[model samples]
Target chain A: MTNMNPSDKALVPFVSVDNMMKLVHHIGVEPMLRGLADYIEADFRRWELFDKTPRVASHSAEGVIELMPTSDGEVYGFKYVNGHPKNMKEGLQTVTAFGLLADVSNGYPVLLSEMTVLTALRTAATSAMVAKYLAPKGATTMAMIGNGAQSEFQSLAMKAICGVDSVRLYDVDPEATAKAALNLAGWGMNVVSCKTAEESMEGAQIITSCTADKQYATILTDNMIGAGVHINAIGGDCPGKTELHKDILARSDVFVEYPPQTRIEGEIQQMPQDFPVTEMWEVINGTAKGRTSNQQITLFDSVGFAIEDFSALRFVRDHIQNTEFFMDLDLLADPDEPRDLFGMLQRATQ
Target chain B: MTNMNPSDKALVPFVSVDNMMKLVHHIGVEPMLRGLADYIEADFRRWELFDKTPRVASHSAEGVIELMPTSDGEVYGFKYVNGHPKNMKEGLQTVTAFGLLADVSNGYPVLLSEMTVLTALRTAATSAMVAKYLAPKGATTMAMIGNGAQSEFQSLAMKAICGVDSVRLYDVDPEATAKAALNLAGWGMNVVSCKTAEESMEGAQIITSCTADKQYATILTDNMIGAGVHINAIGGDCPGKTELHKDILARSDVFVEYPPQTRIEGEIQQMPQDFPVTEMWEVINGTAKGRTSNQQITLFDSVGFAIEDFSALRFVRDHIQNTEFFMDLDLLADPDEPRDLFGMLQRATQ
Candidate 1:
């Protein structure tokens, strides 16, 4: 063993919330969203090369904490995320997250990052990327049904990736719609705050619904949808939570991230176990058809798979290479002699 | 949400390797080992109340990364550990780890700590704790078969928790034994360096076998162990790694932390599927027998479990209160008006 001091191998690159915000400003939010979309699209094309597993969740009375882990044969990534809807009323975030990426060859962590903001960016990017292939041709207007924490991100990602210029926002609470509208003011999008959900859907070719409720609440009904409109349903992510009506799901040709996970947590949880849903990776790789005709309705039922988080972490690990957007965290113990860890501790006194 | 500037709730207390070493010195190693033993014994007594699952592992050509998670209804804890035997050849640690503890009520992380040093402490403490109940009466000598990073900790923990006054060390490499013996010189124990494994067991009532190899190799054969001794086998902790001969296990009454995991990763892996084994928790809680006769041989088939790590994290979380040994990590994203996360990012630009 070499008698070296703690080296760079002992330090993990940690991206804090402040640094992550600075990174967003450094890259520009719209461009970063487009970048995440590109990375996510590339990973989706090689989905078969991933070791995929459903998230391991620990549920309690108030909320659930989950660990989502995935590996791409060379790199391993996992996200530690929690969902506590009751936290919102107590002035806390409903969802908070962080993530890590490690080298698969040596099993050492390479990056540790704050993933709450990144999760939002990646979720929105994934929605827009799927819509690029499944949405109606030249769809420029989207009816955003839930103007919550994820609404402004969805609006911006669509503007960057799918060339959408108009966003009609509606929320159950008017203040939420106003909040999203105020944030999107200077982002070069036509932000329209609507009083009712139906008014938000008027003349819109794409309808995106994202509502946060821990119940089986249908934010979108069957009669509200029109033909050839792509429905981006992102909020139905847990066992007892769904945003679209079953009739709406039965009519639309649905696409999902992973069938095993989406079948249990996505909008299709309300359907049978063997529900016919196309995997988005197959569609992105051209093995499956997407939006065959203008009259056919298509829906992207997203529950936020582990591969999206893996891609987002990959982007962060690459982008933070030569930037001052991260700090070296002394997270690993590197002893001078590998067999003398206790001696190293004893020497710490000197 | 309140317009607070990253309040304490958003910050997790992080203990780095330097801080962990300082903390070990601050509390003193022997006292800390005894303290950890107390926490682990307490948790094991209430083991049925915990949410236990086998560790999630990602295997590769050279190493493996594992996530061990458990919850005790009030707090949730998990450790991210990797074992890459090839790392030691490249002047790196064979094992490195970090862990987190979160509040079950809100799913917010409370503590984040470097667990490389802590895992060594807890594993040794666990072995000594098991020997305290299972070893023969007035047992004062221990034979340490593997003199690697864990040897000195095991010797010290036995001295602290089990009142072991002597330790005989042996290893395949003489340099490892010499290193352990040199570091353990002033620790108030009779440290003996032996040439062979048989000589290390001379007059010792406790035999601790810990060798780091990815394949099954019997460090202790059947005829080496005598009656009325406790065997702490901890190195055989993977699918193909084992340390003790099958005949030795067949003659001993095996005690295991978790049977399902031990059956796959412990010395009992070579035994039959329906091999009789007693849960250690039952022995600690007085529901089962331990060392009933002076001639009975008791073996602790210890493949480290999540509860022991949970106990160690709990010990750290409780002890680091009001101390300067930890730094605050801004790991969560808390926004004013929880639905206005985009507004928080927008305001950060100012």
Candidate 2:
């Protein structure tokens, strides 16, 4: 007789949508964002050790599906994400994602989690962590353009990780800005709802643009941007999409996630082929300079690389070690005898 | 109150291991293998319509994990598979896989199913499907070298799809050979267990070398393979792993699934960079020749491409419709308001 039962190693920890929200509230969202920033920064410091590649994308008429995979020789991770700009008209999120983490030693998935919310957290954390190094000293206010789903998370992450005291929200749609201001009402930061993008940039040392349009729309013109401000550009990630004017990209000292990817998908895609930009990891590793003078503009052009997702999955893996934040999913089949797969199926008949 | 409940679009259909075996029994395994062969053949005919790329792999000291992704401009699919030859030593399957099928329109995953067993069935079906075109006329017996987990599936697939009525099994370990022989006893095929690899090839027209060792082992020497026969070499799927000798590959008119991939992972990896081989799709589409002369040697050097996995997933997706083989998983977070993600989480707390 064979013990046709699944072992613990065969079971993967799965965090569903409900459990992800529970975990967020359990740890408090601010603390979780801060913790994720720490992990993202740690992974960035040792970025040379991890395997890196531009995300593989399958483009359709309506949207694009992408696989972002990376490994640190000990753990491997990949995120399945989709971007459908028209999804909002159909009452769906423009972007949704899920990720899995596996042990590199055996190639068995160890953690599976809904990354729609997690991606939001990690994206904001990555932006703020970069701002901490590139933003001007004594920067207290951030102009948050495009007050959509990511607006609140970006605000809180900046407040928790970058010591920002206030966020000025601006969106073409006033309802989106009102929604974000309402959501951030009791967060203790001076939340200012602005009428225009230029108004939002008033006296702000860090300007974060995260609008959700899939075309080359200049959300920030050359005249709107000033020197000494750190620009966190999050929207316009695909080939035909970008937020900043070409003049701004030419003048500012831009930093990117992965050059091969950011060259094709980030705002730099609008720039010339030989446009010079810095790799953020080099700055984190102290090989390159971040912000030399307050009069020089710095821009972090992010396209959501795989290492941030890997770090987020690693954070969830560590956080769920003792907490009841996930359920065991019988994802893999375990036969009593490894080579007896056929026999295992046959025994099930009896 | 804002509804925190997800919509129907957020639910992805999930098939578990137990359900996969049940579905196999429900549809009858032989018929499923034949159906999978049909789908594989159909996709191969339209090979130029697919978006093809070499699989993205993350390798470690122990094994490799890979993501095989493809799309037909309508439906998108990908398989997550891990090959750790050392797993069997610890009472685990050497390869375990799961796959996803998504609508290319919205980029939402429509199905997620366990593919550990499905992979074995599909790999065998693909081999036999190619042999149907390349094998000698009236070929009834196959020499199945390396009687590990994939042996029985290959035998059945060949018998069901390619009209092979008999199989001869040979392996370095007699216990593995005996296990496969016992499993195939009631499958209405002439199953022969041979002690030596050469004895298994006696009077056989199709030779399948599917040995499981990770290193290069010459399962079939130059003199062992007779002319006017078809060879399905499957196990040498990674770098530094091969089964057939270079001399055999040099003399044979080799056919490959995808040349870009086969050049690195197939038996042709033992050959030169400019080694001539026909793409199997060209043969199916009637653009190239296959098995023209009775005295000509033919080889199907299969390293398993993404299109085969795509076809298998398509077959499973079709079979699972209007059936109880799947359960809806809350995989994606869908809020009623597309941009009100924070509101959705805030309501979940209530």
Candidate 3:
């Protein structure tokens, strides 16, 4: 008879892509987005307790692979993500991700999950949650420039968290806008397909630019962003990539996730080295001001910090308990006698 | 019927720990170690092509979690590992690991496997391979200074690759020595258990010190190490952990894997910053001299590097083809249209 504890230690809960989608449907997307936003906000409130560091990145001419790790004393989490803009031309997703959550007490992995869907969810939840504090009061409209894989999630997250009801979608590729609009049908938002980026911004209190390209293309110019609108610029996330013009950054009150990382990978990378920016955690903690006046322009320059992923993993860990959305994977070697690893290998044949 | 192409893209091969043991038994351990050593040697020969960076680590008072990533312009791989010395008391392995190999062209993971067992195998293979090049000519006996989980693998690897026929084992705990000796029985090698570290080194041409503890430790002093002996000191793999006295290092020709990491984490952490050392890749590439004379003392200060893990993953990826040792895991979200991730999630319930 096989002992149970070694097998228990061997089995890590693995949330496959199918299971993750099932979990999403089980919880409902809107409620899951709201749950993610709540966890992110709570983590942000106690940000000082976290062990934060800039993501370790390995860059190539074609793309980049990054490892983002963080710990909060009790648990540790990390995401393995790759960003390749050229992948879409070959009928592949431009970004794919997987992540793990481990118990910090004994250093054994407890959960492993596909984060491609979860990252899109948490990123949108983060944008909407930030907009709740920084956007124009009672904001119900958003201009989503670049209607691609992330557009639907960003629109729905705003609808769920910040009560935004309408989305004005625009993309250079007209089929992208149609695709996003088609997928978001019957979900919960009024989605408008616009030909021009300028036309998409009509009557919108928030503008989110998430174009996936490797170049330093300015999708939004200084004149494009008007006063009192919060801009969520995420596509310009690596070195030598920025979406907004520098003059636009000069006019906006920029807030970032983590200063050390944001200064290198966010929209603030285009600005001067000493550019003033507020850390969003302090704003959420009430130590720093967010939106002071209706006429002030605000920009949330998110480069996807590690703490946000840590929070999302925590949310998934809490949700997968007593649920059938994950499989038990024997991903760690747990010998009956910890010192007899070879004996375990020998006994496997018996 | 649902489409299969998108589902194909979603699958990644995962080798669980149990399956890893089966794989080990299917393809015997000695052959696998030799294969891993061959891959590692080839990688070291072409080291310039790889993108090598120090591991990203998160350290707490309890332990450390590290992510080591490397790419050779074609394929990318990374390992997620944790080291917590206090874990054995809680019935958990002190070190547990998992790894992933990914395609760089489109940025998707190709394989995910348990590396705790693989790491032990590869670490032993590396030490044996190094001994093949640096140990005294026709060396047949080794003194394994720590009889823990790694002792049997190290002893056997030397027997397989370096022609060592006997291992004299020593550990502070007598039970550990007995355990290792029991495991190595009937394996065509003579194993001896010793009470003290000094007694184990009698007539041995190679000394492998792999004690497990977190401190400024000196398991071997200068007087204990004889001339022309190759010392494999690996147990002290982090800051404040050293297994050899500084005087012993001063008298030896030190070879290291990635000097930047070794200076901080290897036995050389106790040495001066500008202490002379040679990168092992240079030796493998024939650019540097190794063990030039019979009377010269050689010390291989090993603090495992990312390239070795990259090589180990490469070996596993090649071995799993046409083999029933791995399962296809749905770890990536692949939509039919690539952009309709929301639709993919929506259809999972049906």
Candidate 4:
């Protein structure tokens, strides 16, 4: 019943996981991460252009699922993501996500893509982006606490963006540390598996906490940190779930993605509501200082934000348009006369 | 990489729009509406069991898009919907939607279905459900103020659930009213096309206002509304949008799906913060009152809630299971070993 030609520009482009991986492989993960970081930084600089809201979350007995939606005046994007810590026991990833980007003018979805793998990449890219501005210059060593599915990306992105040359990894599970180290092999970085969280912090210029528990377990205490170290706190993203001790936050100049949201979901959730925190966008726009001195301690509270997904989706959509690795789904209905939606249904029956 | 057998009980069945329509045709719309009404009522009775949040909306210059998410302990559901009143000029539906139902235990989507048509159906069913409780017992005639794409569904659903025998229709566009009447020709209901809203409401026991305007246009005023008339105010949703006059809300005992949401989106938005309104579930569960007297005006302030879509998804999933019209989508990655997500990328290269 659609009158539009098959080559009409109104049709939406969809990218599945298989095609997304091809795009990553073609462009290389490091470059994709760098490009995504640039888009994110640009969007963050024009933060007033977005319509933002703290994500609406549904908490169950096992885990939580959330809908993170944001829009510029032109494009709207939302990510459906779930965090189930015990899912690994049931042979499932702790996090799975999918997202959509729609045209605000007509309110039609222009793109839909799997965001499971993309989230890992963007989270790492965001962490690395913060480190570029907040970390000590030429930081060569990083201590990775709770090395799991995310550890490899964090290590690689940090190395690519911040010139981190060595990673000391520690996890409650030795197998996870081995997996992280194995993934980093031949990447021209020294990987050391430490027995304790304290041991991992030794000689490290930056410390990244990526633990995956649903509770407030301090993976990094105040005593475990040293001066001039940038703490990329990635895993402590929900209320009652934190990896850094409160004293650690007290001693560091904390930077966050969105203060209203990060204060409720980031490690700062453990701190008072009036606790001091600077938004990372301020640092990116040069409105606020990032690393004032080489010996100063800084914390990047890495609770993911909607702008990051918006940037990643745009990047994927652009790359997919230039390539042929994506699939097109009949996601939107195209009627010869859109008012005759009923007629389209009747034709489908025939 | 999937190792699970086809007969695995852990499998989550999905029914797309094509399959869902086949199931609806097989069962017939009348019975399906009745079934969905039952499910919606059951959920509404136990509304306290749900985790409710006011929908997250992003409003642009042209239109508004919203994410409505809700969950019980077992199943989580959310719908992505948009309302662009001017979209019909651009050959697009005024409202388009899609939704997902996921298993809370594993955070995997069990069903993904198009909600454009289903939303129209469920919205009508929900209106009928509320009318059954709020309307006068022998209500036989409904004054449909706006004859748009949704008018036919509302007429049929009201006939099926509330024994509505006739509909008096009025629309700014007479062609839309003619279309509604033509679609309902065989539905065994008397259709009277009227020139004005005042003439349409004469002797009508139920008045349904489903007009599509993004401003505060008063489609119905207090002088036009009759005593004991159950007003199904459907279109006054989002900020700056209202169908009924503020005086009508002040006169009627308004009932809403969720108070926090209806406060911002429903007709109650015009009222004060402490303005008294009844939650529909409380009335359904017999904790609150509905139509205490025959002459008392009752208003169902329907901005549409997520739970109705959750029920609709559940209904479609259950009905489409025994049908063969669905396509299997490899949306979720099923790894032979869950920890081997990296292996999926490696295998894709080959």
Which one is best on lDDT? Answer: 1
Q: Is the docking of candidate 1 incorrect, acceptable, medium or high quality?
A: medium
- Residue A57, model 1: Cα distance from true site in angstroms: 0.5
- Runs off by more than 4 Å, candidate 3: A1-6, B1-6
Better of 3 and 4 by TM-score: 3
- Per-model TM-score, in order, reads 0.98, 0.97, 0.98, 0.93
lDDT of 3 by residue, B18-97 (tens): 77887888889889888889999999999999998888888888888888999998999999899988887777788999
Which stretches of model 1 miss by more than 4 angstroms? Answer: A1-5, B1-4
Q: What's the count of clashing pairs in each model shown? A: 0, 0, 0, 0
Candidate 3 on A268-318: residue-level lDDT in tens? 888888999999999999999999999999999999998888899899999
Write the candidate numbers in order of decreasing lDDT: 1, 2, 3, 4
Docking class of 4: acceptable
Compare the candidates by DockQ and give the number of the best one.
Answer: 1
Interface RMSD of each: 1.4, 1.1, 1.5, 2.6
Question: Across residues B177-270, which tens digit of lDDT does each residue of candidate 2 receive?
Answer: 9999999999999999999999999999999999888888888899997789999999989888899999999989999999999999989888
lDDT of 4 by residue, A81-131 (tens): 889999887778788787899989988888888787788888898899889
Second chain TM-score per prediction?
0.98, 0.98, 0.98, 0.95
The segments of candidate 2 whose C-alpha lies over 4 angstroms from its true place after superposition are A1-4, B1-3
Better of 3 and 4 by DockQ: 3
Could you report the Cα RMSD, in angstroms, for every candidate shown? Answer: 1.7, 1.5, 1.4, 2.9
What is the Cα-based lDDT of residue B24 in candidate 3?
A: 84
lDDT score, residue B202, model 3?
Answer: 97
In the predicted model 2, the residue pairs found to clash are none
Off by over 4 Å in 4: A1-12, A333-340, B1-16, B272-275, B292-294, B333-340
